[model samples]
Structures are given as C-alpha cells and as structure tokens.
Target chain A: MDRQAWTTLFHRLLFTSAVWIVLSGTDAKALAVGAFAVPAATWLSLRLLPGRDRLVLWRFLRHFPSFVGGSLQGGVDVARRAISPGMPLLPGWVEVPVRLPDGGRVALGAELSLMPGTLAAGVRGDRLLVHLLDTDAGFENAIPREEAAIAAMILGTGKEVGP
Target chain B: MNDLATYAFTSIGLFFFVAGSVGFLRFPDVFSRLHALTKADNLGLGFIALGIAFQAESWRLVALLFLIWGLMLLAAGTMSQLIARDALRERDGR
Candidate 1:
C-alpha cells in the first residue's frame, strides 16, 4: 500500500482498537482477546469498505456544536408539531443541486435528514430530492449551509486532502 | 445533585420518546413518520445516555455510553435515508 493507504490502515486500526477497548474495558483478559480480535476486525473493515476520503478533523470539530444544536432543535420541532392541535404540516419535496463528491453527498444526505424540518428522500441525477416538513420553515437556507459544512469536512476548503 | 440530574434528564428523554411515538401514530405518511420516529428517538436516547452516564462509576463506562449514543445517531441518520429513499421509489412506481 502507498502512504495514504498506510495512513488509512493505521487510522482504521486505531479506531477499531479504541472500539474494542471501549466495549471490553481495560481488563488484561479482555485485552488478550482484543489482541487477536482488533486486528482481525480492522482487516475485515478495510476489506469491506476501504477508505476513500480522509475526514478533516478540525473542520468536523468546528461544525460539531452546530450539528448537535441542530439535531436538538429538530427533535424538539418534530415533537412539538406532533402534539400540537392543528397538526400543522406542509409536507412536500424540493430538489437541490448537489455539488459534493459521492462520500460527501452521502454525509450531506445523512446530516440533512437529521436536521430540523428536512429529510433527504432520494437522488435524481446531480440533485438531491429532499422532503420538507414545512416548505416555509426556511430550509431553503439550511440545506446549502449544511452542504457547505459537509464539503468543508470531507473535501476541505479549496484544498482536497485525500487521494 | 447527580440523582436530581439523572431524574431530570431521563424525564426529558421519556417525554421525547412519548412524543416520537405520538408522532409516529399521527403522521400521515411513511416519510413523515420516519422523520418523527428517527429524530425524536435519537434525541431521546442521547438524553437517556447522558443520564445514565452520570450514574456510571468509571470513565470507561461513560465513554462507552457516549460511543453508543454516537453509533445510534449514525444508524438512525443512515437508516432514515434508506427508508425514505425506498418509500420515495415506491411512491414514484419505479
């Protein structure tokens, strides 16, 4: 493997080891099992889905707070609308042009679906078909902002990081 | 103080869980119901995990709780997309 692939393998191994430690705790006996299991799992993971893109950690960290805040708002918004007397809903679909690469697009779709008032339904060509809980809920602005964030996270700002 | 926090957090979590269920029953279509179920339940689980984390005796247990919540968020986000996509495809008769 090249340097980038080596880096990906290292990161994946580190991640899998961390997961094993978290799941099994720090007991020597558990770690003895993990000594065999962790590498096996990491190898299996790489075989199943080799890393295509590197995540920009600082960008993700910068966006993490807002993402959490948005998810909280989304949960509360849906709950309030659910129990309200009027049951106000203007559900419909809107197609937004997608600019990110494949991995970034998947991340964008997942993130947008978890955000307030929007659910990513499907993809048609280069446009993402989004279902809005309320068309007037101002998602016209939200989706683009989210897309920009995801791009920054996956693609970086004007300088791509991964091979 | 920790007990009080646990109670408060869990109660809020329970409220969201109940609200999610209500929305699931009340929403008109599959997409909307998924919107309710996934979003609300994710938040609910997060709060409950936070509450439980407070009671955890060790930092490892707390970390595990956080990991669980993070996994739930990813799972719910991806699962909602898959379900929504399938529903959309079915609706379009494709």
Candidate 2:
C-alpha cells in the first residue's frame, strides 16, 4: 500500500489495541499485546475501509501532543485558581464562530472541552458556545487570552482566533 | 514503590479538583465556571480512578474503569462543543 495508507493502518492498530488491552483486563500482557495488536488492527482496518487510501495521520497526530500539553497547561491554570480563588476570574460565555466544516469543527470543539477550564456549552451551526473562567472584568480581559489558547490547541496555527 | 507513586498521584489529582471547584464557585462568569468544573472534575476523577487501579488486583477491572473514563471524556467533550456552537450562533444573530 501507499505511505498514507500504511500510516493510517498503524494508527488504527494502536487505537484498536488500546481498546483491546482495556477490555481484556490484562495489564501484565498489555504492553506486549498492545505492541503487536495495535499494528495488526491498523492493517485490518485499512483493508476494511475502502476509500482514497489517504491517511490523515498528521491530521490526527497533530492533536495528540496537544492533548498532553493542553492538559498540563490546564492543570497549571487550575492550580492557580486554587491558590487564589478570588483572583479576578474572567468569566463569560462567548461564541467562537467556526469556519471549519461541521465534522472538523465538532472534532475541534470536543478537543477543546478536554482542555482544562473550558467547556463547549453549546453549538448552533458554525457558532460555538464557549464559557471562559472569568468574564466580569473583560471579554477583552479574559476571553481572548483563554480562547486564543483554546484555538491554538484545536485549530493549530492557521485557525488561531483573530485578535 | 508503585503504591507510593499511586498515592502521590492521587493526592495531586484531588488537589486539582478542589482547586477547580473553588474557581468555579468563586469565578464570575459562565465560562470561568465551566473551566473550573472541566479542569477540577477530571483531576478529581483521575485520582480516584488511579487509586483504584493501583490497588485493584485485576487488570480487567482497571481497564474497564479506563474505558468508561475514555467514553465519558468523549461524550462530555462533544456536548461542550454543541453548546458552545449554539450559544455563539444566537449572540451574533441578535
């Protein structure tokens, strides 16, 4: 198969294997099983899903690192709030208009929610209902800072929200 | 060694949850409050889950717990997006 196809195959394998290990309830052999099973599943899925054979590994993997990074960033934000609960938390719900297709936008939204201290409260068409931690002082003050962070994590550089 | 590590992780996890809740209650807006819940709840749950995982005798049980968590994250995240999208649409129109 082509390069993208192979890449896609590998990813599907990892995801499938992860599911397997979890379901099997055998951590003792998990790493071992995961190592091989993941790849096996990837190959099998590639064969099953007929299409352009165009694998979006980077398309998805690009977000994987953000998962860890964003979570850590969020963790710090949480810690900050804990230390100073009354610290002028900027709280407000603003809609982030999305130009992304329905699926892409939906995917992005879900990922954002996974980030610390942000919630995808609602969605109507391309509009997103986002609630920031503190909005009292400023939409200028709070929303932009956090939204920007959220945008970067979700949309990558091209999707950064305009200031 | 593993037990100690698990305990430490649990402590940190609990700490984050409390912090998030404090922010949620104290914070001034819907957005901030949401963040407080999103951030803190996950950590709180993570710790509790980790403790159980470490203490449990069966990998299958732990795996089940993890599976549930993954699904919850998926569901919650999607719901968050839907709400955000709808809210934004209403404001721009009005």
Question: Which runs in model 1 stand beyond 4 Å of their true positions?
Answer: A158-163
Off by over 4 Å in 2: A1-21, A25-59, A82-85, A93-95, A123-125, A134-163, B28-30, B47-66, B82-94
- Expressed as tens digits, the lDDT of each residue in B7-92 for candidate 2 is 88788778877887777677655455556666566656766677768877777778777677667667766655555555556656
Each prediction's TM-score versus the true structure: 0.94, 0.60
Tens-digit lDDT string for candidate 1 (B1-94):
8998899998999999999999999999998998898889988999999998889999989999989989988888888999999999898899
lDDT of 2 by residue, A47-157 (tens): 766434333546445655657576666667766875673574545566776555444555556666656555666565667666655455332233343444445544454
Estimate, for each residue in A59-152, the C-alpha lDDT of model 1 and write its tens digit: 9999999999999999999999999989888898899988888767778888887799899876999899899888888865688888888877
Please report how far candidate 2 places residue B50 from its true position, in Å. Answer: 4.9
Give the top-scoring candidate (TM-score).
1
Give the Cα lDDT of each candidate.
Answer: 0.88, 0.61
lDDT of model 1 at position A154: 70
Worst 10 residues of 1 chain B by lDDT: B71-80
The local lDDT score (0 to 100) that residue B29 gets in candidate 2 is 51
